[model samples]
Target: MIKRITDSSAASPGALCRLLWESMLELLYPSNIYCICCDNLIDDSRPYSLCDDCLTNLHWANERTCRCCGKILKEGYRWDICTDCSSASHSFEKGFACTEYGGAEKNMLLRFKFKEKAYYGEKLAEIMFDRIQPEELDVDLILPVPMHKRKEKRRGYNQAAILAYHLSRYMKIPFRKNILLRSRETMPMKGLGAVERRANIENAFTVSRGWDTIIKNKKILLVDDIYTTGSTADACADVLLAAGALRVYVLVFAAGANRTV
Candidate 1:
């Protein structure tokens, strides 16, 4: 009898080729060996694959932040909440972020979201995880601000989901992607005023069937790539609260500049 290689026992030609290609790529161009922001060489010990300079230059949101929205407030600004938060009531209980949305942070996040650099999600999530206080981890579950099916399909992946997935791993919280969904397509939020952005995202999200029971009385942690105007986050929080979630707190990678009047 002759022994034959089964599909399970033998490497397929395509798999072998891919393995070789990946091996070659790793040998020639290693991953995480360079800073994600400036492409400077970084060591394994560097947190978030960022160099010392990039890390120092990054706009961390650890300074005075808006009490309601978590965006960094300018110095000498006496308001607890940002101008945007003061003008409108957000559905979320509160929010926190890892960095301010500007300069290097903005450029990096834009590349992460629109340029298909999904690996950035991991480092961003790690930073966001560091932003969460011990008491904030009391949430019962974690969820991403969902993207519409069409948009997600077109974009290849939902950035928020990617961030939330990594964040769940870091925080050891249960993460659900499909429980909260974007049920409607909306226009681009860019260039939209606060009211316009709110209206654009209104009713855009809904809880899936059978999730209401699980959501009921649960303290939820909502994750997103960025928080601007609180429109999308508020919309998602509204639906989650309506589905019986006791509380929805937001964790975003970046918070837009405080629109102080």
Candidate 2:
């Protein structure tokens, strides 16, 4: 098991040396160090698990995006509000994504979620943090989009909670994991149209009883791995607002280009 390192029990020189040696050995072994993006062998000094070539191709969301939803748009647009935001009424005030959901980002999210690669959560959270302004996004509480009980039991971890923990630490905000509860497991939103996705997730989430005492009137930032149709976030935001939250905002690692509202 990986023990949390406390100040009193710092890593010893021998342990550090052993870790470095193991990392070097893994790099030397031809089959061990596979790229997180393309499953290709990566060189020893690469910062991320992705190979340099894949890193070059990685698409970061650097364009001027929607002020409300952060969807990248074509040039000559006014304030980057996409058609979806222009037409739809979303519950959350605004949201931002760090990257587009494709290529390197898709691979990373899959590994993090399905392969139980927990370390990727930290890297992903860091990337998400880098894209937002802490002061401007001053939130009273940080909440991870909750996983259903059965799903959490099966996976043994909630990726969104893990990401929220790191983000709370980095931003000096209080991370409240229990405020929002997934009341039911909805069908997967993949391949579903926006309206269908919304209906699927609608009423699937609820604020935990008594959580109102902790979250009432608080400005909350909801953290999640991906933003697709905005259904899940919208549902959660609706519940949170109904439960007396002053405002809600979402932070997601990636946004799908094909999805809107």
Candidate 3:
């Protein structure tokens, strides 16, 4: 089978020009490697973009995590279901999270979203897709949680949508971006309780009209940058379910920590 290039950013005109320049550089110099995070020189033989130091420092979601949401459990906690998942009802069937939301991981995500370190998304997507096999999810389509038009206009990109696009191409699953629409903008859900978060995001999303036929009975993988209380995911999934999606699965870059505070 032929391999399709999965860096969706490269599809855009600006990105295409950059890719051409990089191609020319590679041809002329023959060898140069840069770290995905620090821009430090790296060995050309490395398969991933991250340098060894950065790779060693990056945190992976490798704890004894919850079955439903993938949140890391506190030590000596034997239950598979996390506190949040146990008490709440999530519209999605399951979730796969890639890293803890703390320290270097948290800093990197903040940079990815707030600082517009856009290329970081490609590395995050590569990690997420590697950890959770798309074929295993059996999803017919990949849908990134949508952003409100106003916010997206200022931001110039929806970070989650970037991840979803790359995932769709790498996994060879169809991606329909506009099918799931964010009807309104929401305040940041940070520091809110689960109930408040759910309320804050309620009715924030809707499935686009005339797309019901395409989504009906199809399995969908909902993509996002982070999973906090899952309020955003639930709101999005609820609409998809209402539109007759068979089930929705979630994949995220990181999960909010289950702190003891």
Candidate 4:
């Protein structure tokens, strides 16, 4: 008949400690943090928010590469420029990339573009941030490949713009998305031959009116998601140079296997 003392009840010190511990966790981080690539639970200390395996699988463009286009050179190759770069007339002074455009890298880019995975740009930009030395490029401003109004509306966001924004923050350079405009949205360039790619993007871009003076005589870095045949970068570079930009350099997250000199 004596009243029992329930020491393990909600009011007990052990229960209170667990509650406080959970509350502190809630205060420290989001309820559901996961890796951006594989959706695995990210370790508390992993700043990249991507699993280590995915990070390891990222194909860094770390071979003897073309100085102009950054494509992997054949073994025993001695030329500073690869065959593709030596043959092509690239408008940009130089182009750089963090990874080759295939395998896991290709899949990630495809998702970032068409699968509403825009946040993937964060990791891509981080990778490129280490590869690009903005001071050496001496870029006055950063510009992203613009999307046409209708296309941007349909896509919800421009992947290139997201990358340029992160790149700007890393390099402490100003970013301008509107300076260079995509005059019109053309058909998708996927599977297009090199010549077709060039034709597809030719004259597809122009500098916005009145803003040309700002970039005139000032170096510019053009940002994009991928560098395929260099046609897109070249096209954008041509427009910037035409607008009097002192020099236009290109930076991309991935470099395609097909390189045109």
State each candidate's clash count: 0, 0, 0, 3
Off by over 4 Å in 2: 1-35, 39-50, 75-79, 258-261
CA RMSD for every model? 7.2, 6.5, 3.9, 12.8
As a TM-score, model 3 comes out at 0.85
Task: Please write out the lDDT profile of model 2 over residues 1-261, one tens digit for every residue.
Answer: 111221111122333443354345445543226666677876656655567877777677787777777766545665457777777878999988877787778777888788645545655676777877643786999999998878776665678987888788778898877789999988888888889998899889999998897888999999999887688999999999999999999999888773342
TM-score on alpha carbons, each prediction: 0.88, 0.81, 0.85, 0.82
Candidate 3 lDDT over 1-261, as tens digits, reads: 111222544234334544455456556543336665666787766545667877777667776888988777778886788878877878899988888776767767777777655556666788889868833778899999998878876665678887898788778899887899999889888888888898999999998989999999999999998898788898999999999999999999888876444
Candidate 1 lDDT by residue in tens digits, 1-261: 111111211122333443455456546666578787878998878888899988998899878999888999989999888998887888999999888887889878887778656567778888888899654558889898887887776665677887788788778888888899889899989899988998999888899999899899999999998888999999999999998999999999888888776
Q: Using lDDT, give the best candidate's number.
A: 1
Q: Candidate 1: RMSD over Cα atoms?
A: 7.2
TM-score, candidate 2, is: 0.81
User: What overall lDDT, based on C-alpha atoms, would model 1 receive against the true structure?
Assistant: 0.80
Q: Model 4, 52-106: lDDT tens per residue?
A: 8777887777777788887666567778786667777899998888777778777
lDDT of each: 0.80, 0.75, 0.77, 0.75
Better of 1 and 2 by TM-score: 1
| Best model per TM-score | 1
lDDT of 1 at 156: 59
